[model samples]
Target: EAAAPRQSVVRRVAASSELVQNVAELAGIFSCLEEAFMVYSTRKAIAIDELMEGSRVSSVVEDVFYVLRKCARRAVATGDSDCACSVVNHVCAVLSQRLYVELEMRVGQIGRNKERTLDLTREAQYEGLMEALAEQWPMVEGSDDAVNTSSASALGASAMDLSTVSLGSAGPGGVDHSVLGDGSGGMSSTISAEAAFWCLSVNNVEAAADNVATVKATLEEEVRLVFDDELESAKLASCIAELDTVRNDFKKRLQTGMTKLCASLSPRLRSALGVMDGASAIVKYELTEAEFADNDGFNPFVHEFLGALERILAPHAAVLSPALFRTMVFKVAGYLAKQIK
Candidate 1:
């Protein structure tokens, strides 16, 4: 009886030791996987070039998600709910803290840079106007010689005003003026590439939401098949809910990005719409019959304004997704209507 009791105690201790060992090994595996994911995601995020060509979604976005799906599937294949949950949690953290933040920063930079460029263009136009006015009406106080001198003084004063404004200026968030331009050919390319990248980011967010949904469905199906225990299945369901949260986050970011993009583009459209003010002034007066019939009564300013608007929007059509492009169009139309009113 004593020997049998001792053997039973030994067997129980051995079983407990085996369980602890299995838990430790599982933990070690999970830790290694998490570290590897972090390194891979960091490298991929850093390696992305703003100038890289992408149509619907960025290559980096696709690559990162591919790795994430593989990792998640591998964890699920282990038939361990805790292991799967650990991987999912790590994915959410990587996306929320790293990839999403990077894309948001890029979009913000583009908006600030674009606003600065628009400001510079407006300043240049003002300078041109001042020069033209000085040439046309020389601000003469005394003689024809005085006319030239006075005009020169006026031009100098205008230049000083422009210099003061430009020097004092800072963009939203106090962005450095150097980012607007550096008087080099490369700067133009950089700005263009960044703008294209901004568009890519918007599309990538939309794609990410879709990809997350697909991943959730796949993981859920696999979890149901692999986990027969009700408790394990329930735990997996809870883990999958984290993806739903992530997908919602992506959706929110997508909306915000689209709104910011539309807002950035608005200034350009508003500048183009300035011609309408000139047109309104022209039409405020009574037109002669001949003037009404001129050029089949087509307003030249309207035609020119439409052409300018088209030129501004043409590049966006190719880069932005269909839904985003439609949103931009509707927003522009509403703005136009409001301005006209």
Candidate 2:
């Protein structure tokens, strides 16, 4: 019932070019208006979770700054302060409301999550300010120089516009987009800065879950083959040392795999959430303990491994498409079965 006015405003902003142009004429007063909006929107702080919602806020904000900065530069290049002012003012009027509305939503959500302590609401409002600038700039698409093909496509950035802003070609405090990607798609030194850290973490968790079972099963087999019947003390000691070495190596490889996955997404997202770390601990096994125990030594190893794998993949369980998940589990199971030889 109360949303009608806001909806009407949204419609006006979306459809009425005259409204935007009129606001542009008042660009001289925009600074004051913007301050008021900022104060209103950021009356309360935001939570980390809301700020980090799927990393969209960061992307949106980045786009905003990139576009607005370009607009300012282009205006200066053309000696058209009025055009630039209009664009900036138009964005503020329209996007400021969006920010205010989103912040209102956040305020409502605050009571829902009682455990949240980190307030980033102010930061989010600042981000909205950036996004406001971006939303006003007319562009076919947005792009990020920091990520590889995906980010390139997602951000839809070019050397002259968005990239220019980040590189600070127009002003101070600009970001260097070159650090986003090397020709080799490695993102090189800038991978650590990507925000989509979850991609890397999730892939690592997936790889670990998939391979841990097979590695453990194979190592155990090697140990069994070497030990056979009861051996002499010297041989027993040698076998134990070999098994220990294998176990250590396996753990190292697991870490390496996880690191590699993170490195893979460095160019795309400047940072990542460690969600995969938590997700890896939530696996569910199909086999019961008694059932695993019934299979003797081999059964317990496979059962436990499967359980861990399931938990590691649990976070992805509800994804709209389960085809990939099913395939991964099938591949892991097939590998374990084949390794039995």
lDDT of each: 0.58, 0.33
Best by TM-score: 1
lDDT of 2 by residue, 1-341 (tens): 78999988896876578866665555546444544443333332222222232322323333333343343333323322444334334333333344324333332321121233435754454334334323332221121222233332221211111111111222222222221121111121211112122222233233323333443344334434443334332343342233344334434543443343323323222111111123322123566887556555344233333323332233222220233335434444454444433
Which of the numbered candidates is closest to the native, going by highest lDDT? 1
Residue-level lDDT of model 1, residues 1-341, one tens digit each, is 88999988996897589786797577668857775776577566546422233344556677777777888787888887777888877877777777777566545543542233335543443233223322322221111121111221210111111111221112232212222122111111111333444566687788778888988998998898899989889988898888888889888888888777666555455556655454322232466888677635455544445444444454455555777766767776677778778
lDDT of 2 at 179: 15
